[model samples]
Target: MIDQLSLTNFKAFRSADIPLAPVTLLTGLNSSGKSSVLQAFVLLRQSYDSSTLFSSGGGLLLNGELVELGTGLDVLHEDVVHTPGLPTPLISIGLRTSEGQNFNWSALYAAEQDVLTLHSASDAQRTKSVFDRRRFQYLKADRIAPATSYPKSHHQAIGLGFLGASGEHTVNYLRHHARRPLTSKPLRHPKAQTNNFLDHVVAWMQELCPGVNLEATEIPGIDAVRLSYGFDGTAGLTSSARRRPTNVGFGLTYALPIVVACLSAGPGSLILLENPEAHLHPRGQSRMATLMAAAAAAGAQLIVETHSDHVLNGLRLAVKNGAMSATDTAVHYFRRRGLQAEIVTPRIHEDGSLSDWPEGFFDEWENSLEQLLD
Candidate 1:
């Protein structure tokens, strides 16, 4: 897992080094650079996946499947700080591993070009463990909504075991790997019908909506799969009439990939989630946090971006409940200072209490109460 991420003259950061943990939570207000941090991971993943980063004449591809960060002018820090000894001002991204290996990439700035040429060391010699691995998932915030059918990509769903950046291939993945055994004990759902992947997925989805069961079936002669949900009592009473995603509320399908991503996690996997709590209720959001912690305990490294306070409290609850060690979790509260983004990290104790609560850091409830009382 990445121990730290350093940004030099990157978007919204002149120079910043953010510490990472087994489970890292990035929370802050709008446009405070939280998404930018996650974008860096996707950027690297995109470069590596396209085989450009590993080639001799390789560089950063600004537009790719994982992320579409525009030209150099858009990504270059507004007020760039140059290295004292370097002749040119360049954009550098450095990733340091827990085992003390460093991977640094520096790109020359072009005003309107999408691809930034590399000015740094050989990408072949650098450690590409996290970005190059197959067990990686990056779910974007603007994910797929309620749809009648989702596309099926054999290479992505079967060969790569990828659920897609927007989880567009999730139904196909489920249809193919439903019966696969869940090896991770912590991620297994006790109430699940079997030890199979699909069963565990249904059991966890039931947490969001009670008695809810789902199935993914391949459409005949089509490169697509369909998802259908049915309640327990309704299945027996109404001759097993299933409900499409459009009929059910938005939360279940929206959160499906998150559940699958967490369940699929294992040792050496890296999962990056953007707004995992989107379209879910407060309780569902909290449950998502617990699942994230459980994934960490099961040996996967998760980096989550969320704005929900319930998610924060649920992480604290997980630490207190012994699901994961407090020391293994890191919470970063981001806020904009002038033109740059500054981060303030609050420590979590064994008791699930925070060392400090900065202003605008999930304190809206207390602030509103104070106003009402006054």
Candidate 2:
């Protein structure tokens, strides 16, 4: 797993070394650089997949599968530093693995060009395994909404085990791997009917909405899959009746990819999630955090970008519930300072309390309560 990420002259950061943990949470105000951090990894992964990362062309592909960072000027830090003799301010992205291997890829800036040329770098091949398609998943915030049909991509869903940045391939992936036994202890839901992946996914989704069950089925000849929800007992919808995802709540479809991603994790897997609590209720948001904690306990590393305090409390509750260790978690509160972004990390204690609570760090509720009392 990557132990730390270093950004130099990159967007929203002139220089910063961010420490990562088994389960890292990035929380802060809008555009405070949380997404930028995840984009850095996706940029490398996509560039590597497209044969642009270290090819003879040997450059960073700004527009690719996972991210489209645009021209150098768009990504370059506004207050970029100028070293003594370099022609252009180099933007660098590097990572140090827990195994102690280091790889830094620096590129010289070009105003109009989308791809940036690498100026200097260490041996990048030694760390190539970190970007393996099977071991990584980056889910962006604009996830799939409630829809009757979802696209099916055999190569991405089955071959690469990717759910897409928008999690568009989730239903197909879930359908293809439904019967696979989930061997990871921490990830296995206790209430699951069996050890199957689909059961575990349904069990976890029940936390968001009790008695809610799902079925992902192939849609005839076309490259598409259909997702339907079935509520248990004689309620609004009968257990025997199948309802399209379009008729169900948006939260279910939006949260499906995250649930599947967490349940599908294996040892050494890396998941970068953006707004995992999107469309979820407060209770369900907290439940999502615990599910992520379970993923970490199962040996996957997760770097989550969220704005929900419920997610934070849920992670805390996970640690308190012994799902994971406090040492395995890291919480970063990002805030914009002038023209650049900065991070303030708070230490999570074993008892689920934080060592420090900086201003504006998940304190909105307390602030509001105080105002109401006044």
Global lDDT of each candidate: 0.89, 0.90
Off by over 4 Å in 2: none
Which residue runs of candidate 1 sit more than 4 Å off their true CA positions? 84-87, 122-126, 234-239
Model 1 lDDT tens row, 1-374: 78899998999899999999999999999999999999888888888888777677688888999899999999989999987787657888888888888888888888798888888843574555656467899999988788999998999988998899998888898999899999999999889999999999999988887788899999999888999988878546331778899988789988999999999888888999999999999999999998899899898889999999999999999999999999999999999999999999999999999999999899889989999999
Provide the TM-score for each candidate, comma-separated. Answer: 0.97, 0.98
What are the per-model numbers of colliding residue pairs?
Answer: 0, 0
Worst 10 residues of 1 by lDDT: 121-130
Could you say which candidate leads in lDDT? 2
The TM-score of predicted model 2 comes to: 0.98
